[model samples]
Target: MDRLTAETKIAELTKRIERHNRLYYEEDRPEISDQEYDQLVRDLQELEAKFPDLAKEDSPTRRVGGQPLPFFEKVVHKTPMLSLGNAFSEEDLRDFDRRVRQAVGNQTVRYVGELKIDGLAVSLRYDNGVFVQGATRGDGTTGEDITQNLRTIRSIPLRLTRPVSLEVRGEAYMSKGAFERLNKEREEKGEALFANPRNSAAGSLRQLDPKIAASRQLDTFIYGIGELQGETVESHSEGLALLEELGFAVNPERRVFDNIDDVIAFIASWTEKRPSLPYEIDGMVIKVDSYAQQEELGFTAKSPRWAIAYKFPAEEAVTVLEGIEVSVGRTGAVTPTALLKPVSLAGTTVKRASLHNEDIIREKGLLIGDHVVVKKAGDIIPEIIAVLPERRTGDETPFSMPTHCPECGSELVRLEDEVALRCINPMCPALIREGMIHFVSRTAMNIDGLGEKVVAQLFNDGIIHSVADLYYLHQQRDVLLGMERMGEKSVDNLLAAIEASKQNSLERVLFGLGIRLVGAKAARVIAEHFGTMDAIMQASEEEFTQIDEIGPKMAASLVNYFAQPQAKAVIERLKAAGVNMEYKGLRVEAGEDLPFAGKTIVLTGTLSQMSRQEAEEAIARLGGKVTGSVSKKTDLVIAGEKAGSKLEKAEKLGVAVMDEAGFLQVLEGNG
Candidate 1:
């Protein structure tokens, strides 16, 4: 291509890459798959290399992508945390091996290979063997200090075996099991679910509350070092050993090889065994073991010269889009799933793939009989990635989302600003079953022995129809024991769990009801505000809107839900069954003499003693309004460590500033 064409392409690529970087790094929501994103970066790099004169110093390819989140304190690394170049094929790995050999004067190089975990990268610093601070890889030079959240990960050691000051790098991740359980809980609570385990882990770690992080079962694996003091480790494998000795969790599957052939073989073997692992591994990272060899290999502008990630090809299989099937979720959202011709993908039989929604089907131009490209998303969810229009026959039938609920025949409505079509009928059988499942979920009602499988079995057998029926199961103990997988001990345990759920806080009951737009947080807030189930049921939309976080939409949802006879009947049955619905959680009501009375406050950066949520709650109790962003209306800006642009903006606006100690003093009415 000519220089002008290259220049235009470079500008386009730069804009696209920056957008993707913001989505993937800052937002933790990526539009494209990692492989597709890599291809884009590769294209940009090739163009820049061909036309060096058009290349900009601030190109996305030249620097780390993320920036520190404003919620946490900023941490500057002693050594830059650089990303690695990717190797997609065997030939790519061979080329990488050739470069390493050539750069190191044709010397035999020993390499260490570790699984590339699909999770957030973090840096943990230790001072005198005591874990001091932990931070996210927000760009390479700077990060968000999340020490409190990092401490919650049981795998991360608080103190090392030796009193040595060092900085170590690792990947913080949620196991697939943990992710599934979390998602199940979220679904039950009427919350938007995370896409994958990686997203779940990243979101969990980035939470402003350490308590929230602690609730999520997060794990970590230390792979390398950033900087070390009083330590002598010559090779990558040796460094991992030292980290493991210091009580850090290290991946046991890592192998050391003298040649690239063995590394390639090891990578190949994982393709079949990948699904068996408990966590997610998107690829394999190969690094030259010797520190001396690594130094000699030098570095690229963005990646280390000694390391390359061999990304496994996303497993894809072509299958016929046999039919479109619609299912109603707990929230009554009608989701269209693609019923595909059975095919093998990623070592599993793939009979169905997610079509997502009507927009996707229309965008992909998919038809009932069209040949579609199917792939497992994160090697778990089967999804139709694309359609082969050329392979489409004239007999292919186009599909559309249903106009009415398939289960209850209720008129479906598409909410404003949402692509999903939802059924509004509260008594729909599918909705009732889903609601019953949610009511007994671990987080909602804490019914230990009653899982989704058991809930389905009970629902299918017509033994339990609603949440209230679960509470009355004691009378049907004999019938429960007659069911499959139900013994005397199990039935007794389940009944005991159901009875115990009756005494839970009103928030749990509110969440268990599966009201639209009412998640766990909202349920807690609303429950606290109303104090009783009756109060909430009788609350007007205007009263609901007066609450701290409730808006008109949520207020309307609550009013409409309570107005339903079906929901009201269930609540009556639950109440009749002796279920408690009064808010039992701690609440500090606002007082006239409170220090923060009638003040609007904004919190910036990380608070050491309390989480962002706790601070906000405290402020609210003192009759303070906590608003996002700094403005002239903001009465005070509580600045903590590494206060960012909000602090500066508050200063510019002449808003009063208070440190953590001062804020605590104000909370105690001693300021």
Candidate 2:
């Protein structure tokens, strides 16, 4: 009726929404259905739209997600996100305990042993209990600003239970269910699938758009604190407890171990039971119990020597090699996959492990009917770690590389410099599937809800025959709904995602197409130079090479890819589907808007603007390049405070140097 009435309405609605948010997110108990919650949010939106003056900055609706960030500005962490030392096996855990004991002398150190989440490390900042910022562990000093994206994670509390200004650290991970669903959706969209959960998590967090990140169904577990303004922590373990008490989602599996022996036993137990977990765990961290003891051990230039991350035996399990399936890649590389007996390993059921190459398979003497030992190298992929030759039956069939393309029966050939056997057939279904999967990968198209199962089902069902098939999926919602797990909501979400994917700018689509040899960085270069997907597809090999980062091999891949009738058809379908085939997004640069264009850069010290990864991404966007160390080849060194050996080396070599301020100027046009 009036402004006062609207204000009252908004206040009550905010309270109601907050309560429901707490129930669904914090307590995992929902009083309102998702649809009901959606309606409430819509009503709130409508109210806000009608009475703009009633809108509050602290509104729950403001926290859903926001616009795409051009780049992450660096924030100097008050306390460093130091990496923990690692331990492998029981003995390694014991050694860590012994080291802690010897360092602390006798003060009964009780450790906070936590599962080393095989996911991306992120930092969350809360100002007076209000979630304000979230960042990636770029270089442990500075990270990209991903606050909007981080808010999408339901597990990460938007507002602390109490008034506290604190920085919490944790693993941002994709659960088994989410990962599987993601892979399935990708399959349907002919998008490339994530190799493992860790990559998926990392990619999801790095998304420029928070909405994209939120759609991925990501979860997080706070494990440590960077800084707490109004709190005192007695022990590292106590700090974790404090985080939990304050309403931050901390990993519940953490335990306090008195002795290395007990820690070792704990490690052993997890090593055996890791498969039962929902997410990946690369290792276990053994930290000194007391905060004082941890401070005593101190830093060692880079990593803290006090805490060790004892990795579980890389999570290995045995499975029977049922069949050898070969898939042709976009690069024309033929990869053999070991179809295995469904065995649980590394938080996922292992049914297939990549053979990588014929050489690898031959090296392992992999044969059908042989028992195989599989492990996630970093607790990610189900790699055929080894073949159990002793378990091979007398009648086991020796596996051989396909002499021809399995999809089109074209003779398989290996590139001179490559170890892979490749099928050159353009019309190969497997290649298209693999290419599509790669296209939707986090590093590529980044379509949410698209995962392996959905892709395979779509392909098998003929709903998606090629990458172009994805663009048509929006037109086949009912057909997809008929498939298992493809509920109406899921189908609608998938269609909406597909529709959203079209507007993802040129570089993303370029990468999503799974162009052989054209990596992420290269895709950006192509997008910038060509400016349109049609132009990029029409570009010659010479044109590709003229774009920096596009080497001859990459050029050939681009040319060959565009040359394909099938690929061209897909592109046509994608274009016709209203995919934004151009780049109109922000290009952060100063002189020419190429922030890093033509600059040979070396990043040193702790950046306060963005994580090293975010910085790297920014550098690429600006057309600048970064080298690992200072050399004659270097252009400028962006030095933060305490920029160690690299600074010294830069000074010694007469390299042009810019302070963090100058770098920020170039990065943000601050000057």
Question: Relative to the true structure, how large is the alpha-carbon lDDT of every model?
Answer: 0.83, 0.75
Q: Where is model 1 more than 4 Å wrong at Cα?
A: 1-246, 250-280, 283-315, 331-333, 343-349, 356-363, 376-381, 393-426, 517-521, 547-551, 578-580, 583-592, 598-633, 637-652, 658-671
Best by TM-score: 2
Query: Per-residue lDDT for 1-671 in model 2, tens only?
Result: 78888889898988888778667655667898889988988888888989987887667676577776544454546556767655545666667667766755656677767788888988888899988887888646545678788877767776777889877888898888899999999999999877678788888887767888878988888777776666777688888878867866677787887767777778778878887987777778777776655544555645786788776556688889899987777667887888999988755667888888888877888889998888876565678877788876697998777798877788888778888888766677777777777876655665666887778778877887777678887677779889998787677777766766676768878888776676666777777777777787788989888865678987897898789887787778777778788875434343574545677888776677666656766776677776665678898888876676577778889998888777677767722
lDDT of 1 by residue, 32-112 (tens): 996887788789989988988887644645422223222455576767798999888999999999998977665679999
Q: lDDT winner among the candidates? A: 1
Cα-based TM-score, every candidate = 0.54, 0.59
Worst 10 residues of 2 by lDDT: 584-593
Instruction: Judge candidate 2 at residue 453 and give its lDDT.
Output: 74
